[model samples]
Target: MEADYQPVSRTDAECLWASVRERASDPHAGIFGPSSISWKVNRESALFLGAGRAALLQLAHPWVAAALDQHSNLRNDPLARFHNTFRVVFTMIFGTLEQALAASRYLYQIHTRIQGAIPETVATYPKDSRYEANEANALLWVYATLVESALVAYECVLPPLSPGEREAYYSESKTLAALFGIPSHVLPATWLNFEAYSRGTIESAGLGVNDLSREMAHRVLQSKGTWVPVPGWYRALTTAWLPERLQEEFGLAFCRRERDAAAGARLWLPRIYGRLPATVRFTGPYLEAMSRVSGRGVGALTRTSNRFWMGQPRMMFAERGLGDAVELPQPLQ
Candidate 1:
């Protein structure tokens, strides 16, 4: 919260929206430096989504209305008005295609109570922040991405947008990129593609803050622009550095519970050994990259990855350099 926030500062909104546009690549900090997107505030932002349609009703921003409208019109078809925006800006990073579609339906479902938690959650952010602004397209796309992801993860479904429909989705997001003064080359060719899609939402690509998470959403809502503990909270899990509430809200604890399951050896192996070695801090770029993936891939011709979605797993032969390299004596100890 800004110290002098007046709830509706014409000047402040101007400055904030300007900063939001300016910090598109890295809006995790305040207008200047040092001030950041407090992870605590992010939980507040998620509260907004958790609040449901009532908050959506209270949310009067043109873009929010537009997204609502877009979602409504696309409910029957699911891809007509929202294909590319959903895919490139959102659908890829978080939830599955099925989850995205359910969120689509929920956002537009008629006469139903939109729920208390989501609306209450949404109320936490200062409405004037960039997340609700008309000019910041990245905020819009990423918000849609997150809302859809959270809904999908909770609902779990299949949102396969066909080839033709997919192209239309791509087209809409591209138009958004240009309208917001973002470079065309910056937009991702595919969702979660990171290469192209990351461009649509960056304040600075070189800084390495990509993907949507509660932390980034807080930045957008607060218009502060800092990248909080989003991309890799697991490292925080190892260090016990994250707030308990944020961790719980995002379900970090549930993942650890996997270790105790009877036959879930597949998930346990990666947690104990495939990941989290002793050679260095648990936070590594590789770990961060791996975090974005949901589900699994085959580890080789032989086995699986930490998650269970089943794509293709990557396999590497054991190496002999670097001081027993992360020598932790394996989980057998």
Candidate 2:
């Protein structure tokens, strides 16, 4: 892997982004082009900071919560659960066309096996109402939560993007949802529509807080069942960063002290993080993708910085293996 790393010139980065944007109009445009807004926003490590928030928001939906409670083992091995989700998300954002398609195909197969009835009724879904991961509405809910949470995380941990950039990012994100077999019509047509959808989901009575959602929320906040040790500040930030609606639904109380800590961290952490060299800010997959497109090796500074910035360097290196090129199936017609 070290042999493949090299410095990326500004000229190369611009060229790659330009090519990707040009191809964005092609439905058949490969998984991600340089012009892809996802690359611009998702390449930051700060995105992972929102993982707990995303999980909590998804669990707020009783059907989504019930599905995990019955068919998933999030508490049994949270690291693996997170890795599975993160692998698919990152692959879509940073992997080559073949890798993105391959990862999506794998996830689709996993979703096929995750269908069952909601054990208890919440809102319109009766106790026996069936829930399938592949169901259009259910899939849309999950997709929207993930996208919204990611953007929220981005805003919290990085410099704000222009409204236009955010819109372009949402448009690019739909392409990703499509890769998961969600029909285009089922997805929100624009960022404004998505915002409305998100607001409704958060405020809906259907998104009831239940025993299962509470338990899952606890595990996420405490970082239980995961291999990595979540920093105390990050855990606090997760609670503070969560939407007020979710905080109330989950029954999380932030004392004045905790709120102050969260506020200070939010203001300073991203500013400090932004000051880090690009080598320190980006992960290996992103670096490799830039190398592949620009025909240049990522710099040694990247590996050197990983040792300094990574909480667990072993896990960081392991992720590179996950992103290595893989055999890909043909695109769905």
Candidate 3:
């Protein structure tokens, strides 16, 4: 496998930002507009169904697991971590151009501070092998998991996208990858290529789950900070959906009862969930975008839902300051 672990350079990031600004015809619509498949797929509240799958997939990557274990407050405040994550991501996808740019800069700042060594020899990485949160390859894997898991969740409760739609969505997602500072040269050229990359990575040693990864996986699935405990059916489905190798590596139990529960959800969830009202079915960020376009402005209901998704009543961008001017590391020679 390619071993380039370089973080994004300041020059590259600036170029990407310029391209995004040039392409944004409607600044209020952010990167993807209302008609985008990204909006259509991500707008659904049902994407929450894939949250566990995405988390577990991320944990399976030793670099991500190590970075979180060493630098994140996930064990102490998973909900806050989760909320902060969604806040930045949703802002990039659904906020205005200024908000999206601010979110990207904020995220870039956070990533620059997160660098460490692997605690133990896991998979191909030796003990004390370095990891950086801003590394393009690791970022790509995390991005892939989110994109694939969202599709999995969306299809679980809604009509599956056609082949052309899936390709279009993947094409658009390259922009999201650019926002993360992943170099275009390193990204898969097409959706089919992306699927192959995901499958190949899953089978590679880089994704071996170590002790910390297993512990973190369980902690995330069992976390109950403020919110009610994760339901059994949800856990069952998460475990069932995971690649069999990773499931064994994580030691997640997928007994017949769990299997039955996951099966039942697959059988009935789509039929019932498809009938829900738009307000209940769609995400707050999408609703807020709609309100922005309609000139109605965000309302109390949207604000309430925003709190659920973003942990705040509205997306907050840092005011212009030194911190807002994210200081990237010098480019790798």
Judged by TM-score, which candidate is best?
3
lDDT of 1 by residue, 288-319 (tens): 12332322332232122211111112111123
Clashes of 1: 44
Ranking by TM-score: 3, 2, 1
lDDT of each: 0.27, 0.66, 0.81
Which lDDT value does model 2 have at 188?
85
lDDT, candidate 3, 114-185, per-residue tens: 888888888888988888877789889988998999999999888789999999999998888877777888
TM-score of 2: 0.80
Give the C-alpha miss distance for residue 3 in model 3, angstroms.
1.6
Backbone N/Cα/C clashes per model: 44, 7, 0
TM-scores for all candidates? 0.22, 0.80, 0.93
TM-score of 3: 0.93
Q: Which stretches of candidate 1 lie over 4 Å from their true place?
A: 1-155, 162-164, 172-195, 198-251, 256-333
Candidate 2 vs 3: which has more TM-score: 3
Cα distance off (Å), candidate 2, residue 122? 3.0
